[model samples]
Target: MKKGTLYLIAILWAVIVILPFLWALRISLIPTYTTFVSFFPKSLSELSLVNYEYLLFKTKFPRWMINSVLVSGGATFLNVLACSMLGYVLARKRLPGSNVIFTLVLALLMVPYHILVIALYLGLSKVKLTNTLFGVILPLSANPFGVFLMRQYITMIPREYEEAALVDGCSRIGALFKIVLPQALPAVGILTVTMFMETWNNFILPLVMLTKDSMKTVTVGIADLAFQTLNTNWGVLMAGSLLGAVPTVLVFVLFNRYFLRGLTLHGGLK
Candidate 1:
């Protein structure tokens, strides 16, 4: 393709991706009743923060935001820790049945998690974990993709570094924490951002696990706002959506460099 054609395609794709957020922003600034009156505002005076104010103040949106943060943050942390250890073991240690375990992880990547929702709900209910933040976090704490990415990235790292550390009397765990993990920072960044976004935007799990309004994540809370009454408040719903998207955007921005570098390295390795 020509450079101009490629540029045009890129611009079109960018617009396609950004159009929804732009529309939401526009709707969020106007009154609820004015949402469908016109796509473009008639005057600058029509725009206001009334919807934002209502979402932030007269609703449980703040609590929902807190719940989302706790769930996403906790899940991300556990994914990083658990995936790293599992990836390291699968990549470096020749434990018995290690190949079988790795194969199972690969197989899990093919399985859709939605089908397991019933089992998850039943198990959590048995443990009295329903309607709790921890229940929501636990199910999202580990992912097959995270383990696969970490293992692939870790395999590319030089074993000589860990060998030298061992020769210097460093314990295996010490070498992992000191030598391996630091070098695997790029993969860790990718996992962190990915897990945080997935957990933050997750609706079904939190919706099923958390029946209490105070424990609902932002996504579920916003969904509730949409259907809580006879007439939907478009402005507030858009406002909540816009606000809910901010943290994921911030997380991506913070880790973008590492994410890109990890993908590049992983692709190069492949």
Candidate 2:
């Protein structure tokens, strides 16, 4: 395709991807009654902060936001720490049954998480972990995709770096922190952003694990807002959704450089 054609396609795709958020933003700014009346506001005068105000002050939205942050942030940190160590081991250690372990990890990537929900609920129930943030965080803390990503990226890095560190009397764990992890920043950024977004936006896991109103994450809380009343409050629901989406957006923006660099290197763009 021509360069101009490619640019046009890219622009169109961007618009397509952004339209829903734009609509949500539009709806969020207007009165709930006016939501279905038109796509575009008749005038700027129609816009108001009432929805945002109500969502913030008059509901459990703030508590839910805190819950989401705690759960998603905890899950992301654990995934990075666990996956990094496991990936390094699988890539460099050559431990017994390591190949079999990796194959099982690969198989896990093909298994849909939905199927595990029942088992997860049962096991957590047995441990009396249900209805707690830890329960939600624990299930999402380590991802097979994260393990696979880290292992593949770590393999591409030269062993000479860690070997030099080891010769300098650095412990194996020290070398991982001082040598391997620094070089794996791009992959770590990718893992951080992806895991945070996945956990932040997760609905099913939190919904099942947490039955208390105060323990609900932003996703489940917004869902409650949508169905809590006989008539749905579009304005408040959209407002909650927009706010709920902000963290993921900020996380992506903060780590986008690493994400782009990782993609470029992995894709041979340079």
Candidate 3:
């Protein structure tokens, strides 16, 4: 009876989560002028791709897509690489005042990121990067959470492996690449997905930093389309949102196994 009830609850929760996407998809397919009471279209004749057509051909959405990809990809790559290397160093190296540095990193994790936005904007503006993709990427690329997460994962690795590599004439950097990193791929994959998703979905920073229509990221671009003073395109907005979600979804799905492994926090070889 308990198992049956759990299954029932799971099904309900899944439906609750998926229902919004299904509704948006339905709205995307149905003609903008028509209203239907049911969950699905009334007939095949009522379905249309006009929203997608407008979204692709008539809007600056393609540019937004490109900008989003470049910015998100750049940010994720730098973040994962820097965090992993820093994490490995912090885990393996015992430099003077390292504990104080780690404590500062932990303290940073407690502070909300939004509090830094104004200061970041002012600083980036001074460097003439206010309207650039690099501005978006630079400010966000070295967050403490990624560093903390990677450090935690690296600590789980047995030091004996690094010791063995060192005895074989491997330098600290060499062992990081050949020994520690290879073992940390699962954690890295999870961090990549996380950083990519966060950067891709980031709205406020890009909205503030980028002034030109050509430089707008997808999230900001979609908001522009949705909030137009005249002829607001609800159908196109919904379609764009659904399509915009594809890459993040694909990243998670493609790295599903690694993501799960990262979450499980598996330790080094027995």
Model 2 CA deviation exceeding 4 Å by range? 1-16, 35-38, 257-270
Reference-based TM-score of each model = 0.89, 0.88, 0.89
Better of 1 and 2 by TM-score: 1
138-233, model 1: which lDDT tens digit per residue? 988878888898898899999999999999999988998899999998788878877887789898999999989898999999889889678788
The digit string of per-residue lDDT tens for model 2 on 62-137 reads 9999999999999999999999999999999999999999999888887879899999999999999999999999
Give lDDT for model 3: 0.85
lDDT of each: 0.88, 0.89, 0.85
Model 1 bad stretches (over 4 Å): 1-13, 35-38, 258-270
Best by lDDT: 2
Report each candidate's C-alpha RMSD, comma-separated, in the order given. Answer: 2.9, 3.4, 3.7
Instruction: Single out the weakest 10-residue window by summed lDDT for candidate 3.
Output: 261-270
Positional deviation of 81 in candidate 2, in angstroms?
Answer: 0.3
Worst 10 residues of 1 by lDDT: 261-270
User: Residue by residue across 178-221, what tens digits does model 3's lDDT show?
Assistant: 89989988778778877887789898899999989999999999
